[model samples]
Target chain A: MKFGIGMFGDSGYDTKTNRFRDPEKRLKEIVEEVIQADTLGIDLFAMGEHHREDYVVSSPETMLAALSTVTKNIILSSGVNVISSADPVKLFQDYAMIDLLSGQRAEIMAGRGSFIESFPLFGQNLNDYNELFAEKLNLLLRLNKEEKINWKGTFRAPLKDQTIFPRPKREIPVWIAVGGTPTSVLRAAQLGLPIMFAIIGGNPRQFLPLVDYYKEQYALAGHAKDKMEIGVHAHTYIGDSRQAVLKAYYPAYSFQMNRIGKERGWSGSFTQSQFEAGMSMQGALYMGSAEEVTEKLINTIELFGLTRYIAHI
Target chain B: MKFGIGMFGDSGYDTKTNRFRDPEKRLKEIVEEVIQADTLGIDLFAMGEHHREDYVVSSPETMLAALSTVTKNIILSSGVNVISSADPVKLFQDYAMIDLLSGQRAEIMAGRGSFIESFPLFGQNLNDYNELFAEKLNLLLRLNKEEKINWKGTFRAPLKDQTIFPRPKREIPVWIAVGGTPTSVLRAAQLGLPIMFAIIGGNPRQFLPLVDYYKEQYALAGHAKDKMEIGVHAHTYIGDSRQAVLKAYYPAYSFQMNRIGKERGWSGSFTQSQFEAGMSMQGALYMGSAEEVTEKLINTIELFGLTRYIAHI
Candidate 1:
């Protein structure tokens, strides 16, 4: 089983000041963190994409490209590149170069994005959200599989016998990142692509039906069972003991939760009771001592038949 | 004065085999070459973009992003980003992140491109060439100066109160690269933007008039005189001895010149006599022994009042 770490390059919250950290400092910290992850023998480092002040990275591929030179033995990937609002041609070219630069350790995870800011930013229409993802993913897959492409699509201009340069030494892995959407999972399974479910909140057991659906659909689609890859991403923190970890992590964690929650119109502030429930074995938040966290990870891995697990810190 | 090295990640040509070298190897060499440049105290490294098999880098920013981690003290830039066919918003965001990553060492040199391949690949029409560059450059300048933008253009999507994230530590320098186009030179001067003249062939003295024109227009536009930055990019090779350098560089140089000449439908192949003329003190090619190259560079820098010189290899 592969274990990985993921981050959105979150700008640190200085609880005393109640202000966001400088993005440049946060970006440098991210680079150091990933280098440390590589030193610690982490299998993967997935960088998240966010085009907001709270996050330092707008282009995960760009950040990954920076890390490609400094890190070794870590598979660099986008936790989720909002591909629906991106040009797949450009995306393919960027990641292909990253693959070559990193000696073949680059992967792309496509998603519709958990936020809608990119839609207007890139001139993409919100009404065409599903269609945009479907069409762009189609184009991206073709760009990967074919040396020359002749494709037409509604969202972007058509490619006429075009080929992107700086081709990767090997086929870069492309994963589908979904936020517990059955239709999204079904699409990934049907396409025989690896699926990464982002389980940020609620009960971990609730996703069991979606995981089973993906496996059933994947098998029905005649993909090799041994080659099937399923992964989970969840908010996680680990320390020598649960109390010490909670003491350090909760202020910043709760601040971010409430900040994003306020934007999303969540009715109640995150409470210690809810946080304790989330830390429980049945909940999605993976936080505790090393042994406790490991046990929880193993349980989730076995329950979902996952090939990979990513701690979204 | 700033002196820099620029490359298109040109895949080496094997004369005996009459074949191109591997791009993966060339890319690694590029990283090494830039690191060495930084170590040697080169002020800048400008990567070129090409959407062809002969050139490995199609996204100079991607290559620059990769180099940001490995090299320190070298300004990372696109020799010419072919910005006419690019999205200025994305370009600004990428360079902003690159600037933050490299401690304010990121720059963008915008050009209409010497080749037409990117236009077709990016779904842009040749007919809209001038308009595209004009519109994109305008938007790019606004993105650099403003916290939020409300922009509309004929070529790309309009921006409405949009602000790109991960803002640079300082305003990223944007230079205009012109290939002896009087109109292009005028636009750069009027905008008070730095100008990089690409002098690939013919007599260097011939550009004196264009350089003077830029200075006159720039001063007329009420820009600060000392702030005016003018640069020249030319093919350059430096060696210990003139004969040894000729023997080593001539075969490959003539081969590339003829190859590109053929593609452009030039009348005759590149001859050694022409190469000899190009190597003269009056010529544009900055090749010869160290003393000879220094003399030629001094002459050019003095003649054009250049602030920066980029040796394009």
Candidate 2:
């Protein structure tokens, strides 16, 4: 099993005011953290892409490229590459370039990014969300496997015998980042792509059934059972004590959760009990000392038979 | 005056020959070199975006984000963002995000990238090349200054009061990259934008007149003299000995120059005299000991009265 840390490059927000530090300074600290992780034997370090002010990484590929120069041995991946909002060809080219810099250590997880800001900002329609992902995903998959792709899609222009440059030495590994969508899960399984289950909240046991469903679908699609690997994405922090972890992480996590909840029509406040419940329950928040995290991770892996675990630290 | 270094992240044809280290390992060394430069008081570090297999950094922003986390105080900038091949909205969002990560120290140089692969790969037309850059440049400018933009163009769909998120704390610095095109120079001056001169080969004195032309155009465009900064982008290296610098750089340099020459109807096989001319003549290549580079830079600055000297080391 592989363990990786994912950061949105969030510098953490001041809870009372919901404000962030100077982004430049915060980002510098984030890069330092990645270097520290690499030295600590962390297997992978991933950054998420966000177009909102609270999240600092809008160009994950570029950030990865810069990181390539600084760190060694750690696999570099993206928590999400907002596929529905970006050009698939450019994404392919960008990742390929990163692969070259990082020596084929580049990987990406594609999804419809968590926010709606990308739609209007990129002149994309939210109504065609499903079709957009579908068409773009097909194109992205084609670009990933073939050097010369002849593709036509409704969301973008058509390509006739187009070959992207800086092709990876080998096939670049790709995973689908799905946030609780059965249809998306089925789609990933049907395509025989690895699944990264983004379990931000709720019990981890609940996701076991989804994992089972994915395996069944993969089997139905005639893919080998041994070919699939299920992974979990969780929010985490490791400190000397649980109190230290909570004190350092909860305010920012609550603020961000509430901000997202306000947009998605969920309850906004993070009650003390609810926070404790989330920490204690078999859910995705992997916070505490390193020992506690390792134990919980092992348990979760056993429960879901997950081969990989990614934490948004 | 600032000293920086640029490298084609990929080793290209030398991959099988053991002439260059693998991309990942080489990048780790490069990052260490940049850190060393930072400590040595180098002012800026820029990475170019290239789609060809030989040149590796297709996603400069991703790499920068990773660098933002590790380094301190040095200015982080992209050598070039291919505005012609990339979506302006996405480009703006990515850079703005970089600003957030880098504490508002992020800047970008926009250009119609040197390579042609991006054209067909991204489904853009070579016929509308000028129009693509013009519109994209205009859009990029607007997106940089304003939070909400309502724009329509032939290259992209119409936006109705669209706002790009993750806005920078201040107006993100932008420069137009030019490769000796009078129209490009005029366009940048007309827009009150700074110019990044790509001085690949030839005498630096030849570009002095073009610098004068830009200042003249800026005055004609009704902009203040203090508003424009001319940055020279050149291939560079610093070593303990002049002989050592040549020994390490010449083979890779010749390899790249020959490849480019092949497509442009130039002859194969780079000669030692040509390399010597570029190094000794006041041209683009900045190769030699640190003292040699610093002296040349000061001389160039005094002669040109330039604001920034971006060395492509």
Highest DockQ scorer? 1
How many Å off is the CA of A93 in candidate 2? 3.1
lDDT of 2 at B88: 83
Give the worst 10-residue stretch by lDDT in candidate 1 chain B.
B11-20
The most accurate candidate by lDDT is 1
Model 1 misplacement above 4 A: none
lDDT tens per residue, model 2, B158-274:
778877655677888888889999999889888889888888888888888888888888889998887778878777777886788778888877877887788888966787678
Per-residue lDDT over A164-247 for candidate 2, one digit per residue giving the tens place of the 0 to 100 score? 665667788889999989999999999999999998888888888889999999889999888798999898778887788778
> Where is the poorest 10-residue window by lDDT in model 2 chain B?
B18-27
Candidate 1: Cα lDDT at A38: 98
